[model samples]
Target: MTRAQHPAGDPGEVARAFEEMPAVLWAFAGPQHRVVAANRAARASVGDREGIVGRPIREVVPEMAGQQIFEMIDEVYATGHPVSHADRRVLVDRDGDGHLEEDFYTYTFLPTRGPDGAVTGMVVHIVETTRWVRQRQAVEARADDSERRYREARDVVLGLQRSLLPAGVPLLPRLRIAARYVVAGADAAAGGDWFDSVVLPDDRVALLVGDVVGHGAEAAGVMGQLRAVALQALVSGAGVLDSLRRLDTLAGCLPAAVGATVCLVVVDPRTGDLEYASRAHPAPLLLGPGGSARFLDGAPTGPLGADGKPARRHHDRLGPGELVVLYSDGLIERPGQALSAGQAELARVATAVLSEPVAPGSTLPALTADRLGALLVERFAWAGYRDDVTVLVAERQPEPPEPPALRLPAIPASLAAVRVAMRAWLGALGVPALPAQAVQHTLGEAAANAVEHAYRAGDPGEFTVAAGLDERGVLRLTVTDRGRWRPAPDDPQDRGRGLMLMRALADRVEVAAGELGTAVTIEHRLQRPAQVSAGAAPPEPAAEAREVPFRIEAGADGPRVLRVSGPVDLATAGELERAVRAAGRGGLLPVTLDLAGVTLLSSGGVRLLHRLDAGADPAGLRLRAPRGGAVHQVLALTGLEHLVT
Candidate 1:
């Protein structure tokens, strides 16, 4: 391996080695920055092979090429020292498109050494640097996008949470309700916090506040389900305690299992008397006169989460203008310490608010939530829980109901008496051009049916005939009975005729039927003679059927559902069945007739109930209530107890 035979001895062979190297190598002679030699890679990087072989370095890549070329060459040739840039942007055709674009690279040059230690030629190297620059930019863009999506999901959930809170509390005589809801942060979360007020079948006002276990969207979803379940419980004439216990069970066991914490507060507005039950939730603060605050105690259970705990309730009452603050855990968990101090601070804040002109009766919820929310952050500071904050508050303001959403004249027993009452009530209403005579006749027919058919003789049930005008000036009459009798064939002696006449006169008739009972509704509108003259034959109507899927049980709060399998019925035929009655425990839940279950109704059944509802008690024969069809038809037609509430 002598240097001569190694090919290293030939200058031409050494030059060929440089061209074969992978590096983008180049060289310059003397002091001029001219390309004396350029390899294949340098040609490929600039998209020019032969075109750049003899080109000046500055002419091929104008940006930074001229200045850098001169500086490096001078530094190498004059200083006799090597200088290099590890990563620098240079203009080069990246895709071989002949268009030079900025790319990154490393470049270096060393002073040429002659055989006697004098400079002769310089060497240069280039390595493209675009890959690293583009990769870094992509990472930053992805990080920013993730942040934006997170914020959007959070804002949406918070907005929905606020809308679900109770509309401003209604001002009622001897009843004041202060309500509030607090959302902890602007992120996706479950909101099981809620407040509500309802008028019971007994004319009592029921108020409730509570939280569903867990926090965030899933928790909020379960909370909504439980809230609806609780409302249905209270509406069905459930006693406060019974409703609480039953709902506790249902909230933990729906189609999909979930758990909840709830409270029930039923108040008799007239007497300022109140009753309450607390499930697995906080004990409410009852604000007495002069800002005296007391926590009403109740039996507690574990909050409803994936697993449910037994629910317990507390009981109490308040005078007119008394304030009750019901809330979730966000307020108490403000600091990492025990909540006893939080409770005391809440009481102090309450006292301060009561001393001011702020109406604690109506404004307690807002004031309490705002103050409690702030106090929690201030006192807890960095010690706050990572969970979302939820706050709900309510107070009672003693005031009369603004106006009745719907009211009826007390129902009287005899058909003739009902006729008289209807006329008197209508006269007082100043209805013009009303067919009073036709109305009385229709009223009589309905009353008679209610009295005779809605109940089996001696069943002790009664029907009610209520007539009213809707906001649209349409006459709406409802015939409700308690009989759950299943429909039987039309009586051979008397076919259905009462409903026929009533339908001929009314513009629309809706029959809502179910297993429990049936509701027959008839509506009439005052029409213009000109419009009536156009080929407008009166519409002939008959019973239309619907379905009931849900199963319900009576609770102290209202209708405690054991299970609801069917869609809720709101039609006239289903009204009777929907009008659930919870006669003290151990009472019979009859196999009532509801039209939502029927494909059709017999004329005889319609007539019979029409007469009974009109207040007519048939000849002294005791109507042995049939358990199904025929009995249901009789009750629905006669306005029997089975059909009436």
Candidate 2:
């Protein structure tokens, strides 16, 4: 029933019933703006019990008196119609702490007409809306299924992320196309990093590697926006520099540059020549035949969206048989070191990896991907640099078996014979002209890594090196062995420059190691090296999050749990916002993670517990071992955990 104007008759009882009404009600002098009466809700809303009568509305809500909020009220009062507002946040005007809440209300400040049709006072009604908002959010969540939401979201996210990549590889007559992008984070969920392979309108291929800067939705959002802007700019005719300048201007509004880096390369594909710019992207790994890898010097440009300076471009070229691999910094940059350290680590792996795929046309992508991916996982998995990684490989395709053969010896054991063999082979190809000695050194490294790592002593692995002319007529040399072998860890004390030294002799390096053993490959093209600036593009840091390391003290029973904001996948698990003290090495007590903030948890997330348990680090602390609430309940039914918190 309405709080005001009740049925007449039981006058005393009716008055009692009216006084107990729940809604806050008020009577005011329409023109004077003085309060005439208030029900319990209204009085309490203003922090009063019994003495709040006869005051102006301004006196009760002092803050509002100065704020422009009441301008609408004045406008309404001047007009003779009732007005209402819903779901509006208003500040309660009590002393001490000011609290804000959503409220709905209807009002009539027009002159109140009495029985004589005269003006006296206006009336107002108030209703709380906090519960309504909560209910709406709950309804939205219930309507969404996690699986469908994730699939739809991935399509959207990847589509947006793909724009940051080059449109496609340019058709250089000498080059064969092969490139791939691998997500660094665990399966099912990925981060803001991306790669690009564009066939520029100029016919020069423009390759880009960049990171939008963060892992979750916000990072994803910015990544999508930036990529869209880049494609629009480049595809429309904006030069690389103009695109960089415009991107920086827009970046000022970002939360922080925790997610921006773009390295772009424009190569004159027809001539096997190139010009490039890198913001913070990793230098491309140039692989050649004969098992050699080298980190080429590209003018490291600053990142995109960094300072407001236009980025400059650098230049270079590809010989037939040489390959260039561009990748996101996430491939090398980790939590505890500088870029050089990361670069060094990459070089070590590059040299060791250039083997086995022997066939550049079909098997190279898979072979290159495996070694590179393993390196990243081994180095960063638990090191906590939890960011996404992307790698792209580009190289000249080797020729079909129609090239003329050089006068060479049958597979021989002597180093001199190998040099004589290499010199004769390249001499016949008439490209990638290198000294006999250089060829021998590269060939020796390939043979040594294979003999030492791929073969099980005297087992005589079935691999052997071969030479040929690529379609562009560049020299390609490969060392193949028939036994399975992983990349050998370069011993620092040993003089083995490994692939790094071999890289200097050739333009591209490749290695394929699997059950088929290891193949060390290198390409030495006679194509002249074009001079290009190896400068970094300007810096485009991703939007970094503000992180304050805070510790929560727990009650004897542990703190009340709170859910996290994102899902927990194989890449991330058990960090349930709970902490436990460790007593000894491997001695840990199961701790409950409130999980109030957690939104998604995968089966692999459940499996992480087993991995963590098997390798329990006593000295290193891992928090929230056992997930709880719904997760705990689910695990309970499955008997996965008898007492997992």
lDDT tens digits, residues 1-645, model 1? Answer: 765787466667887887788878887767665677888777777666345656666665543332234545665877677777654534444454534455556777876788998888688887766678557544533344346466546567655664555444433334434343445544436456676766677767777776665666666666676677778888787787667766657654653324566666776766657677766666777777676888877666664443444455455777766676665655566435466666665566555445433222121112332333333232222222344443333444454323212222223234434544555554333222224334543554455455545555456665666666642335667766666533334453454466665665567877776766567777765321110001111111111112223343332333422222322211222332333223212224332223323222333335434443333223211222323332234344444544432
- In model 2, the Cα lDDT at residue 426 comes to 40
Best by TM-score: 1
RMSD of model 1, in Å? Answer: 28.4
Worst 10-residue lDDT window for candidate 2 reads: 530-539
| Consecutive 10-residue window with the lowest summed lDDT within model 1 | 528-537
The CA-based lDDT of model 2 is what? 0.50
Count of backbone collisions within predicted model 1:
113
C-alpha lDDT score of every prediction, in listed order? 0.51, 0.50
Q: Which residue runs of candidate 2 sit more than 4 Å off their true CA positions?
A: 1-173, 177-179, 184-190, 253-259, 290-292, 298-301, 357-385, 398-645
lDDT for 291 (candidate 1): 67
